[model samples]
Target: MSADVNTGTREFILPDLGEGLTEAELISWKVEIGDEVHVDQMVVEVESAKSVVELPCPYAGQVVSLHANAGDTVSAGQALLTVAEAGVEMGAGDEGDGGTPASVSQSGSSTENSSGANLIGYGTSEPKTRSAKKRSFGGKHAAAPAVPTVIPDAPSQPPAETPASPSNSSTTANDRVSPVSSPLVRKLAKDHGISAKSLPGTGPGGVVTRADVMAAIESGAGAAAHVPAGTSPAKASSPAASSDQSDRDTRTPITGLRKVVSERLTKSRQEIPEATIWLDVDATELLATKKALEARTGEKYSLLSLVARFVVAGLKKYPIINSSIDTAAGEIVTHGDINLGLAAQTPRGLMVPVVHGAGELSLRQLRDSVSGTVGKAASGKFDPSELTGGTFTLNNYGVFGVDGSAPIINLPEVAMLGLGRIKDRPWVVDGELTVRKVMYLSFVFDHRACDGQEPSEFLTFVADCIENPISLLPEL
Candidate 1:
């Protein structure tokens, strides 16, 4: 099968969305085939490993075709779509010339085009410019006639075969490659001793989906009568074996922000040698100070804001804790400004939204910044840039009623401070036993960046501020 190739049609391949990421999942396409798109107009939305980003078209023309559908994972440098230059005539190709136009197969692979257009970080096609009259599409010019295009049909498949005799099928099913698109579906098939290749896939292009695998299992393909060797027949045939139908377990693929968080946490644990030290601090004075300030000025000040101020003051004294490890340079890199990361729990997950220059902000400013950033994170409106470049992390787990945790250090940052719930506890003050409001402060640091003494001193300094809020006045 061949397509009518248009010489003026330019193929736009997916460009590299930085941080060494190789691919992205198509979320949705904003423009359809035969639609006139302007330069810099958003064409599609894609979810990369980091975040969901909208891709803009670089050239102004009519969208000739879409290469992949929504939910399809496309690799960098792969053709995404084709756009025909406005006012350009379609010319027939030579009979001897054999090339497939930018077309996508039912199997989700594209036919390579030698004359494909390229973007930065991919191929080497130069950018082309049309005449000024055809440069921008507006009003009447935008209403181009919708040209009907024929999309190639998915490959044909043979008639479905019934389950073969156990002796012949078991080995054949296990050895054959499964035409599955998702890794999770393949895993499910393997766990049940079911061969995905033997089952007729109801998904596009005969690709096996999770639903198809489950259907095969329900149809007795994974019956205990044909259980493979070394497996318990009783366990396989039991009602519990089919309990997955009751929604006992659910598997969700880690993608988008969650995937990024997983990779970053794994890298931090593998690369950084960390140590945690915790101390209990009297927070009666700090709470009283906040109340007094709010009453006198008619302005509310959060405990987190006060704690953040104390952290900044402590960082000034022990600047080493505010530094990050530059492994590539073999040095500890310290910053002149403090970008404080406040860990907030959102509906999606935990995210650390950064306050760019916390050292320069007053208590009120700090309170506002924390509130605004947290609001944005909860609504999923915060930009990816706002989630990065944090020099030190301040996690207030106390809100969740937790007392303490040996929190992981947010890399490449050297340290993270955890604040536990403040509760009234029996304490000795001036040789008398009394109830005092106390909180646990857990400090974790990268041992490579600083020795035990510096972090200990930093934690102690913050603890002192909490105990005696008057001491923070001078620093403020």
Candidate 2:
């Protein structure tokens, strides 16, 4: 490892390491410029949207320059550092157009084409400079770039002549940043077929206020802002765009956890023939059991744990329900032990953590495990093993105060069970209409592996267990 012999130059750029990561913060640089690095050596540690990931150097050479400093938010594909090949001379400072460009250019030069820097060799074009731009959750330095102005109460007007580029104007608005609008606003806009771009905002800095959109609908000018640019007066009078300028926003680049989840879900759906079964059970006793257990053990557990307990016990009775199909071996696996997964929603996406040997655990132990798993899932810190080896999955929609839904079957596992809210429903006990706490359960199964008769019977068995807790006491 001599100090001055690297000849080839290669650039290492930031990569989109996934889970909806738009940018990453450079945590540390492992290799310094002038330090020789081998391919696959740890080059840097960058914190992504979900986790801190170490990126490896792809080229073996001496680190010639660090393009990005620590603490900078780097966009995907932006150059992070450059490496010089062994024995290459550091080129002169003068910019020459004969060889391939240097990496410092604004658009950035790829390592494949960039010229090796040398004192006597052919000069290279200047590399692109790193963009000094940063994005903010709030609007970025809201000195509004001069662009066309649209008013909520009045007609759209041309922007006053100004010096800002059109590209900058398109993205500088604050409306593009707020991802969490109320559900009512979302539904209203969706029903009216109105897009954010078609609105003349009434909120701060011409941002679209929900009330502004509602008013536009009520006042009969709903079509005004939506008209196509430069249309005739009669056609322009209509608020709905004549050509329907909206297509599903499907052009987004697939990266991160979303990509992984999408791929797995697609594969599972395509490969597995799923069959769903529904059950409306009187959960009056199940709710009573939960209250009693919480009171006796002085431990806190949600309805999710209660449902998980039922699922684990049911899978024990119907072991086939907790199995994965072995296509290679041409066999169906019936799990003897249960690793029950409880579906938890996080900001990143839905994740399931398994309760190991769930049948072996007492009710209290099961509750505690589910509580910890869900807590870790919400904070996004569960280890990879905690999420794997699930014999069965449970999605509790009751937390959202919903009634019933057919949840998608988790991959590999034969079935997933959904738990709805416990509400009072009329049940005929001894031929009398009495109000009993009822829950709607939907079981989704892999039709290829699960027999149609077994899924319905399994659901009924789970309902029976839930209804009569004393029946489970004999097995326990």
Candidate 3:
């Protein structure tokens, strides 16, 4: 490794992309070797989580070599491509965001500066134009006026009143009452291209909620029709659109995170002989226990948290459920510590961030970890380690008002415990009929390594534990 050695190769390595992505699947190669590429031109599409992303080229030059092929698994810091920086008319800095486009405008909008002189480190690409024609309103329904960038304050004839800014303008797209907001709310708003000021928030300190963004989008669709009515026929002519459109639709390449998910899921289903066992439990006792625990601890507790704790406790009693079969060793490898994977549905896709060493955590600790990890995963900030190494999985489908579901086992994990909605149902108790809070539980296990008898015992243990949770902590 001599410093004086002429190393002319510029390596384009995979970036971590902030979500702590360690590995990404190559979806496709947009530019082949010998193709003249411009800085910030879209080079590839990688899926992370569920979002399909088009990665832009960071350098302007002829591609000298391709480091990886489509469908290949790539790790962060591994070279994806190589570009020769010689004889390129454009000049830019060398720093790359790993995923940020080479072209960046002053305002940070990626306007690709294909011209060599305009290239910085990477140049910004031109903004993709959304709509060129002005909005119009059709007959019988007058289009609402375009909300001006600034609204004029109403003139009031009052002797004394609250002091108002003389320069107070009307509400506009640029006007925001408060900018400090939760990242989820901001991300939701950005996804819809919505102006937050127009929304009335019901969250803490007037923070926007997920419902607010959804409502705003519903309102926009009606407003879109109204706005287009006022434009001229030539400008307002509707483009032919497919009628079979989903309410919200996006098409992304199967690359990066999505690609990995696709492959793993397929492999798991193909290779694993999985079997499911179902049990209906009377959750009334557990509900009461949860209430008592919450009151005693003076903390907010949900049934999901209680279930998580119960699952963790059950894993300890049924150690095989917490263990993975090491086929190479021809052994049933039982783990000493439990790492519980909590399946969370994110806007981009499904993510299971593990709660490390969950067997040792209390109910409160489990709740906090589950909540924080899911929140971060939804916001695309979960660390890569958070996503891997799960001995078992817990999937709560109750929030969707589901009674029970046979959830798929995450690959490498032997089982997935699905929890369903707790609802009042009539049941027999000591030869008497009674209405109780009932929840159906489904435990799906990989049957290749574990036997039917073992899984049945595991489910029975879990069901009994949930019904009699105090029995689990006698030694605690």
Candidate 4:
């Protein structure tokens, strides 16, 4: 999609973000028109159906145009922006919003320092000699021509007038147009004297996330920022208004990530012949083991991590539980790597972040990896690649304080393991009645992949690990 502009310009088009992702919502522009951008420098941030990611540009030159505005949906191969290559003459229009410095002549090397990581597609690997040659359209690379912003598959609207300077605007939160989601995040920004609208959002569709607030707080981006002391993050309304709001049913259009989740879950339910089995396990030893390990090593350990370790062992002893039915190929695909998927709940929605080669990681390393991936759920920064390639999934419904659930299998994966909250309950221990910590384990599987026997064995093995933690030591 590269086009020649003048004798030295390249129209940068969006690249395929990830597997099956055809479109993404343009969140924001990192570089405004006339500003210089280098290869591997993040030029725009977009949220696809899979995840939110910052896109690095390949061209190192002055930005001449932004094809779409924030909140606009852009498809792959669509022109994102145009960049005027280095060593090119410029007119007054070549300058950015404020104005380009005389330093434009020296933009060759001064503007080419790239040390950022490239994402799924497009970036540092792109070349510098991709500029377009002259054409006969009665044009001389019209420097920064007044081109209409192109938005795909949406209603037409007049283009927004570009501001004179790129800086924070002095406006009230109510008056300022920004995507602030949670009231809690608003309060955080308000407490620090900063405006949530001013801080960059890292959440889905540019919605501000709690992690974004903490980052702002740590960076002192909130210091001396104004948020009215009396201003409530929640919108205030009269009693009559509140009553009217309650009367009308709210209908939210599911489009981005939510749309994807809906389609996949529906497919899982409609296509896969799934079955659920449950067992109540005594978790007294598992809890005690987690506590003992933490006390002895002076390092915090999560119960989920301990249970995940047990699940990995169970999968190894029973590999059939880790297989998927490839209906199209008429074969069962048994993945070699134990790419364990953790059902992560984020502000955006439910996401499964897979830990590649989870079986290879030690207990401590496993804990760290799980913790780090789940931690990113708050910030909504999970890369598209991290959300796929799973052979099995682990869902902790207990985190929501639920006892048990027959959750649907994450498709392409044959089975899913669910953990319930451990609570004090009466149980017979060694022929005597005693109070013990007990939790229900729900194992869901695709009947097409395995029958009752294999899944029963896997669940029983995991149950044994919970009942007697010592049994896992020999296997480890």
Name the best candidate (by lDDT): 4
Once fitted onto the true fold, the runs of candidate 2 whose alpha carbons sit more than 4 angstroms away are 1-252
Deviation in Å, model 4, residue 374 alpha carbon: 2.5
Please, what is the whole-model Cα lDDT of each candidate in the order they appear?
A: 0.70, 0.63, 0.61, 0.72
Cα-based RMSD of the predictions, in order? Answer: 10.3, 13.6, 19.0, 11.7
Ranking by lDDT: 4, 1, 2, 3
lDDT of 1: 0.70
lDDT of 4 by residue, 1-476 (tens): 45443335566677877687777777889998768888778899988888888888877888876665665566777667777778765665433311212222322332322446544455543345323231111122322212211222234854346532325444333343345544445765665556776666554334456677778766655433443468564543443453354347343446568888999999999999999999999999999998999999999999999999999999888998888888889889887779899998887788999998998999999999988987898976787789888899999989889899999999988999999999999999889999999999999999988999999999999999999989988888
Q: Point out the higher-scoring one by lDDT: 1 or 2.
A: 1
Measured by TM-score, how close is model 1 to the native structure?
A: 0.71
Worst 10 residues of 2 by lDDT: 93-102
TM-score of each: 0.71, 0.55, 0.54, 0.68
Q: Could you arrange the candidates by TM-score from highest to lowest?
A: 1, 4, 2, 3
For model 4, which pairs clash? 4-132, 6-141, 193-225
Worst 10 residues of 4 by lDDT: 134-143
Query: Candidate 1 residues 165-238, lDDT tens each?
Result: 45654343334333444455666777665766556554433445668888876766664435767878665666
| Model 4 misplaced regions, further than 4 Å | 5-7, 87-251
Backbone clash tally (model 3): 27
